[model samples]
Target: MADVEEMLDQAREMPYGEARSILLEQALKAAAHDRELAFEVRLELTEAYQYGAEPAKSFATFSRSVAEYDADPGRWSDWHTYSLLWQFKWIASDMRRFPEIPLQRAYDALEEMERRYTQAGYGSHAIHTQRTYVAEHIGDRAAADEWFHRWQTTPRDDMSDCEGCDPSGKVWHLAWMGRDEEAIELAAPVVAGHLTCHVQPQGILSNLLLPYVRTGRLEAAAAAHLRAYRLVQGDANYVDDFGDHMEFCALTGNETRGLEILQRELPLLDRSPTPSDRMHFAGCAALLLRRLEDLGHGGLTVRRDGSDVPLDRLRAELESDARDLAARFDARNGTGEQTRRLEARLAAEPLVEHLPLTPHARRVAIPVTQPVAPPPPPAPPSCSTWPRRPGGAATSTPPSPRGSVTTPSAARRTGGARTRSGWRPSWKASRRRPCGCGSARPSCTGRRATRCGGRSRSAGSACSPRTWLWWRRPTGGCSRTATRAGAAARCPAWPRPTRGPAGPRKRSPRSRARRRARCCHCWPSCRSTSPSRWRRPARPGRR
Candidate 1:
């Protein structure tokens, strides 16, 4: 049993019970009353338990193994200590909340593992990394940070090159501490740099990106995700079973992409035998659908637990899918026409639900309008050409770029004018006001002006008669022009509120009406004039 190579060969070919019995007997005999035998038997039993589904038996044997070693110090060996420490992590993970031991004992066990690793000289990096992780989780931030620094500062030994001992844990620890941005930057050169590949590029990226997401750096997370995607290279088993690609996609608000990947992997899950493997796919699918519902993406209906999903019109599509599955089986003994009919039915299944478009979903799907190039900033208002003093209005013919207009005081003031072509609010505009109507607006105490619902409405306000325009149009009824004209006629000499320097800036009649109706609703007053209200403060004293 202590001859690991020979025993492993036989175990590979033998049934579980037979293999366990042979390994147990030989492991016990190898040391003949030595504490080393006790440790060996424990390791052998623990290995068997790890691969088997019987937790009770596995833990029972493991506890017994620990007891035997405790009873005899002479039997302990460096090999036993190292193997036991490694297995301890697995046992702790599986047996969480079992209450067979206290939490402190688990900590003690991990500390013991650190001691064992130090004694072994090799695997010190692995133990250090694992200890840091446990400390971090157990709320010992001081201990965790200390271990983390050691992991970062200490030089790696040859054993640190092992895939299992890679600095993945340390990188993850850094990420968990709200240092994800730093962690990513640190890991980047290492992961992409050849000298850093020794750190296990794929595994570190997989663990590090998870924190990047929580920190609101989705772009960085996406970069890491691309690396993971590249690593899988589109292997269905790796994507569905090992990589959790679908869950990753769905949780991160990329449902459509995730579902596409899942559909591709579904066939593999259908054939997978291992319960754990099957559960990974099934559980991820279920969670993803739930997330879609949470995001309000599910159609009129949603499926849960074990029911058909809530995809509204997609119910028929699912039934069609089921029918297609049955027909494929039925066609095993049927004619070609049967197969053709099945294929046709399956092909007819709709790829997406027939839900009404949601404002949010539509917004997400809609292409964003980009800013058009702004016309060159109006040449700085030059005092030399002004017909009046620098502080006074021009009284003479204004200078024009092409000298087209000769009218005195007729020059449009482009000094603060935003280009109508690209109407984004200028940094000055934002900084100049706290977002009320621009300077041209009147005080609340000014005379009331009836306007259309759209123009004056505050966000989410209800419309009322006060906000409705009193003017009626010709028999064709009020048009956009009629609405604008009616409001302007009712409120003469007032500047139409502009939407910053943007193009064709005006509130719709509906918003104006809503605004009038909600007058006493205590809406947030747009500050348009507060000196510091602007998004960016105007250059001091120059305005």
Candidate 2:
């Protein structure tokens, strides 16, 4: 009915891609008339989504196929059907991970698993394990302990997890209970590399970091981090486990080392498929950053994928994300346990002064260093970073006693001579508008600057001097700029500094007050600056 071989080949080619899921769904539709072929597609699709952290689709597919299998038990072989029961364990475990799926449903799923296992003459190994996981999810230590006891006593059968995973899960339980000695003892084989799997040694080691530390085995604890992190650093599925490594580093006064772990695994935050995993990793990341902030590295930047982020800013963002996720879970679970736990982690005190991770490393603690800020840019040769205001009596040359503007250009304007500081402009002054009717020695043969409204004192310009604000100027021509025109009018962008017959132009009361009040950047008062320069705001409560 369907081109089963072709679809299967496509799925194999893209074993972990969205295309594989698409092809499987297509094959499933094409094989609806063929029950066996449809069942086969459902099986592959279920496994794909399950392992890929897509619990919803995987569970739905399992339910659909299991109903078909139950209708006619002889339709599939024992091997092909075994996945149905085994995958139930994951479904039950995931139910607890998501609070939206009612917690009661998790219990119901376990009961259903026990019923199915009994009908198939199977042991309770996997069901008991899932029950323990659900109990732990709700923070029910008493129930978790009871389920854990049953799981350990249950006989292993074909339905049980693999040898490698069984002991690793047990190690997690033991460590969680704070029975450090028992956890370490049970994990001896896995820790020593005797019991190995694609996921074992790393999973076992990550769970053991705190256990090893709490038991006075700091050396082994450090060793476990290095070995475990190496294996799991690149994988998103192990993000939660990587979080354990991060928290261990944070609590042991190895925040710098934890930072290295964060830099390598930071990208996993973008790709992690599980919500619970994302939540845990984010919380742990915040923990490491909190430690760094404590050590004065809050101003440092973390480089990732050709971009750098501020340590403190990123820390705040990740902690917010984790808290938001925890709130979602807590709202659904009708408890604040998740919020409580996260707050506790954020508030945890360090467990050690320093723990050197390398073999035969020094016992002395590494000193914490402050983040180094970049140096300020160099100033121009003649002036500091401060803008030169001719009116100021601060560092630079002060205004003349007669109050004629003594700008850097003043010396050359009077003559081609250099000033006392021995510096002069290499080029002539740029053109600017002129203003005001005033003069001293020689300009247009002393015809005198008439009060003409922005009009030149030429030909027939009959206009009165219209008073212009010190700052405002007309946009463009009815006028044009000259190379420092020697004449003055009534209106221009700025009134050119001049020697008035009236003895230093009388200042308005407001203008005088502003001149007396110096900006923090430009101190010692500036009486002659009509259009003031930019100033930095004084810090609060100082000026």
Candidate 3:
């Protein structure tokens, strides 16, 4: 029989997947005769299973370690025991991903961790942090808020996540609260090249990408994507990170860049063992591919499994896969939170008109308002179009210039939609307020009101507000002057607050009244509609 130490070393050298998992399994069996060795082998095996191709098995491995430690506490060292406790969070989080596991099981896992931590004289920081994740996961905002506060107030101990990870968690929660400004502010310390770690800058940078874009920090957003993606690439543990980068590219008019990211990451999709990571990756891939299709690149193909797969087919497969996985998560959680969040992600608009990316990108400024470029004259006969890869290689046509954005018409050009200011919060999108295009929003089957509800009221439906596409119109009865006026619906191109926690958060009465007073109630039934009457939103403080 192979020495367990030798087997574990071999497994570590191997890449993360079924093969590595199998090797660790064998080593676990070999170490079973030696209780101390078995505990050591069990801890290592759990980490492999947690990140390898079969993540569900990790919990099973973790379970055995716990039973052994409890059964003979004198046999295990403090190092082995602490190692097992640290993994409690991993089990708690991943258990919620599968539909088969009841949510109660996840909470039980957390309670177990808390009990053990308290017995060991550890601080409550890690326990409260995990409780926050559980509450937030199930869409229980009040409970999540209470837990988050406790997590914040509890002092860190030997068991809390490293300096990098703790702050990264805070950044994500802040972004979730729809406080992009605060999220970015909190991330500055990590982003300033201080306190770096494998997870630090990557985790911090990915969380801030969309926040920076939504706040008109286009250059910062671009820089973040480039910096963060490099760290996460090719790591099985960073599957969630890859999905975030893909979503960033899709939202920043970098579909081609997204395609490049897709080509690199798609092959590793099956290698990822966690259901939640796979779900996130599929959803983001579908988002990027949808943008490609919208830009007339539906015919384009990506190389997969030694053959080219058309992106349209790829998009359909990913969307179905995402929804299916989301359904499973929703079934388990019973709140439909994952499903609703996925739909929001699929429906979000770009935050930037044409923000550049990476080392090769050029500085592009988005004006508050610019002359609508006249639709280019019909392509001259023989002016053929070609699909160009980000590396400057052309796949098809001969006449088009290199590095051109693949948009169809000036009016419908992908990425042409621009925000008026940095204020396209997705609450407006979630409201599904009707655009003047006269096309009724389909998802909003809710009972339509004959009179516009303005901002605070909703009729009969749970359907979403609308897509990223919308047009603006000017109205006269508005208390706020018509700069980015309420006469028309907002654009679908603006970045909606997808991960922010505060999207559907309840508003204060004073804030609610303030929102009501800003717009006219002339939508869906107003007879007056004219472009000539439209005016640019007033510059702040301008008379």
Which stretches of candidate 1 lie above 4 Å from their native place? 1-7, 10-45, 48-58, 68-81, 88-101, 114-128, 138-143, 154-165, 193-202, 210-247, 251-253, 260-291, 294-296, 299-543
lDDT of each: 0.46, 0.68, 0.69
Ranking by lDDT: 3, 2, 1
Best by TM-score: 3
Q: Is candidate 1 or candidate 2 better by TM-score?
A: 2
- lDDT string for model 3 (1-543, tens) is 457788988888987667887888888788778878878888888887776656788878888888988898877788987898899888887887776788888888888888999998898899888888777777787888798788888889999998878888888877887889988887887899777674679889999988998899988988888888888788777878889998998888887788888899888888666788889999999998888777766778889899999888888888999999888887888888888888999887777756787567763422233468899876322313323324666543222111111111222323333334312222233234443323344554464552332233333322122221222222222323333334334422222234456564565544433332222332211222313223234456855
lDDT, candidate 1, 285-360, per-residue tens? 5555554555566653433334644453343443344355334433432334333433343233222332112224
Lowest lDDT sum, 10 consecutive residues, model 3, at: 399-408
Error of 3 at 519 (Å): 76
Error of 1 at 530 (Å): 87
lDDT of 2 by residue, 1-543 (tens): 537768877787784646677888888888888878788888888877765546567778988977988899887889776878877887887777765687788789889889989998898888888888776766778989999999999889999887877888888888778888999999998888887876788888898899898888999999899998888767666888878988999999888778888999898787766677888899999999998888766778888668899989889988999999899888877778788888988888888888899866664433546689999986322212222234645443211111222223322453423433222322222111122223211223335443344455632222222321111111221122221232122123233345688766766755543432211111112323333432222334545
Tell me which of candidates 2 and 3 scores higher on TM-score: 3
TM-score per model over all chains: 0.39, 0.63, 0.64
Candidate 2 local distance difference test against the native: 0.68
